[model samples]
Target: MHDIAPYLLQNDLGGESLVEFEHEEGWDLIVVNLARAIDRHVRHQAKIDPESYDLDLIYFSQVKEKKGSLRAYVTMPDAIINAYVDFAELMSETTCEVTGRPGLLHTKMGFVKTLHPDVAAERGFKPVD
Candidate 1:
């Protein structure tokens, strides 16, 4: 997450700026805001569903210098890879639509694709056949 730190920091800085920094050089600030907006939008939609899809929204912190991994325990109704891909795409599109901007969703989609270890233990949260 080293790569993501700067943007997150920028978000913090911008939030603190009070002036709103209306015309900043970094578009990442906009993307970050858009992501937050999209997350809210998607979660609202998810809440309306009969099943919440067992989506566990997780966030964690670690030492800032080195890259760190995020761990999640999710049991998707579909196959693991497919669920990851579908969730990523859905989130990306939702983000873009909410933001009316491009590329942010696509970038987040790629991030989702890197998730690993979709094995039995992860899947065990679901009932056996």
Candidate 2:
């Protein structure tokens, strides 16, 4: 997986705490795609009016997998950026976090994860009831 931090313009690493990705490797592609979209969006807005969508106005504070879906904690406030995050979360729920294959939520014991059927079988996970 490629390092996504470089794509983020203002990740706000100085004041608070360092942001990090806590999801699986397969989801790295999803994050990369999202980062590019946000970068492009910010750049476009900067062209129109620099203050309209400044880079520092939004960024992910935390990214993690929870309950067979992606959870992104973004800082600052921006509706467009929030919508991008929402779409990414939806993609993560249907894509395997380990293999990037189309997937569904499965369970092993009490732990739930989004995984393809073959991968789930290999991991001893059962279909969610």
Candidate 3:
């Protein structure tokens, strides 16, 4: 598993503020890179204090309506909500729904979807399996 502790600390927040998957699992490189990109964008463009916000969660799952489509959920403070959403939409073209491939050339919606782990995995995101 990749250690995200150092990255989380770089944001000036403790590990406790992050979801468990951020600490325990070996995420796809695309996911890690996206996190870093969002972090940089939020810090540089939004100019928000890291301590004031919490990265409540970051995870991957399948899009039920669109088979083989994957979605990434990244929850943070409302203060930087627009920035995160914009970034997600912009990055959607470069993100692949299946296999977690990055830098693909395609357009899609980037809004985060809320789904149970079992449902997501069964739908084919299957990060845990």
Candidate 4:
């Protein structure tokens, strides 16, 4: 079975350390869930009356009204593109590189899931297929 990384669903980095190579400029954050990117979310804006409200209230209200963000899309690595196509017989939900833990698909925000070579092997995943 494919092994997902611990805290793959968490808001933080979970347990994995950041890798320098994985760090892309302007993308300091990694997305934790690929589903979140694919999931439909409505973009919204808030109307505020600054003159009628305190600074803190206006700030907090704006924060609460914010919606989820999309994942950063970058070119996939050769190994990862081949791996996902080979193992799942479909395009990957995201791309990733190895860190302290096993390599995993990710967004700029965080990890979505771990890619275990053993799982691919057991499933007879071929690069071409």
**For this target, which candidate reaches the highest TM-score against the unseen true structure?**
2
Candidate 1 lDDT, 13-40, residue by residue in tens: 2332121322112233333443354344
lDDT of 3 by residue, 1-129 (tens): 135323332322334333333211112443456556656555564356556543433222221212222244444434454454445445443444333334233222543322334434454433321
Return the TM-score for each candidate structure: 0.23, 0.83, 0.33, 0.19
- Collision count of model 4: 7
Q: Model 4: what TM-score? A: 0.19
Q: Which number leads on lDDT?
A: 2
How far residue 83's Cα lies from its native spot in candidate 1, in Å, is 21
What lDDT score is found at residue 43 in candidate 4? 10
Q: Residue 33 deviation, candidate 4, in Å?
A: 3.5
Candidate 4: C-alpha RMSD to true structure equals 16.5
* C-alpha positional error of residue 23 in candidate 3 after TM-score superposition, expressed in Å: 16
Ranking by lDDT: 2, 3, 1, 4
Overall lDDT per candidate, in order of appearance: 0.29, 0.78, 0.39, 0.24
Residue 73's lDDT in candidate 2: 71
List runs of model 1 lying over 4 Å from the truth.
Answer: 1-25, 50-129
Ten residues in sequence with the least summed lDDT for candidate 3: 59-68
Which candidate do you rate higher for TM-score, 3 or 4?
3
